[model samples]
Target: MSTVTTPKATTRKPPTRFEIRADIPAPGTPEGAYFHYTPAEAAEWLPFSVYKLLKMANARQIPYVDNGKRITFSGMNIRAISEQFTVEPFTKPARAAA
Candidate 1:
């Protein structure tokens, strides 16, 4: 007599995803989950003028959201964009005596 073999079940892996997160609160909105800034406001956080910010926004150099009349910069928070430009200071290593 031959014994019947049972089939093994296959397990599926979940899809991988990435996301940005911030702890700041959004302004004006009741949700207060995100911190958004206007072009004029985002300029203060960045190292450029509002005119340049607007220009960059128009050129798509920067990311922003437009709601018919106004354009706002908001990722996870206001600092989200500002933090992108953050640079660490580098120090020269000490040289050995000759």
Candidate 2:
């Protein structure tokens, strides 16, 4: 089985505590980053195998929410996870024949 390498641990600052009406969003700022997505939903872009995602979730490799029946990932986290695994194309010129 392939192993997943999670991002390096970092000191995450505690989330700022505040009281705001969730029904109303701040101006110019969208409040749609908190949506959760199923592994199948993320597969559209992540293109990762659903089985792998579930295995990772089961092994606590990736962020997930298993509500005793279904497993889902927050949209923000899913996107971030996908970005972290993206491999940029090689841009440097090939080496000359030695």
Candidate 3:
């Protein structure tokens, strides 16, 4: 009979917070700085579904950075996208004079 042995698997610790870098300069806005966001993080900030965010990226409607294997969005880019969908509150019309 032959003896067999298996190695134990190692677990990784989850990060407490996402990494946000400010050194990178945002495109178009030279004086402004922005942070990068993972796809999931972008979704949370946009308050939209991840699926929709990915779709927008794929369609080239939103700007993103492709770091070989993963994609990231700049804070400035997200803000610009959000502004397009902003809605104003509605108010009732004034009553007509007698």
- On lDDT, the candidate that comes out on top is 3
| lDDT head-to-head 2 vs 3, winner | 3
* Rank by TM-score (best first): 3, 2, 1
Worst 10 residues of 3 by lDDT: 13-22
Q: Report the CA-based lDDT of candidate 1 relative to the real structure.
A: 0.59
Question: Using alpha carbons, what is the TM-score of model 2?
Answer: 0.50
- Model 1, which residues run further than 4 Å from truth? 1-35, 75-77, 91-98
Clashes of each: 1, 0, 0
Q: Is candidate 1 or candidate 3 better by TM-score?
A: 3
User: Model 2, 8-61: lDDT tens per residue?
Assistant: 989974222121223432222345356555666555446577778777878887
Per-residue lDDT of 1-98 in model 1, one digit per residue for the tens?
99998998988742111112334344435554255556665555568777777777778776677666466666444455556667879999999899
Per-residue alpha-carbon lDDT of model 3 for 1-98, expressed as tens digits? Answer: 99898998998743222444445444336443366666666666676777787788888888776566466777776777777678989999999999
Best candidate, TM-score = 3
> Ten consecutive residues with minimal summed lDDT in candidate 2?
14-23
> Which ten residues in a row are the worst by lDDT in model 1?
13-22
lDDT (0-100) at residue 6 of candidate 1? 97
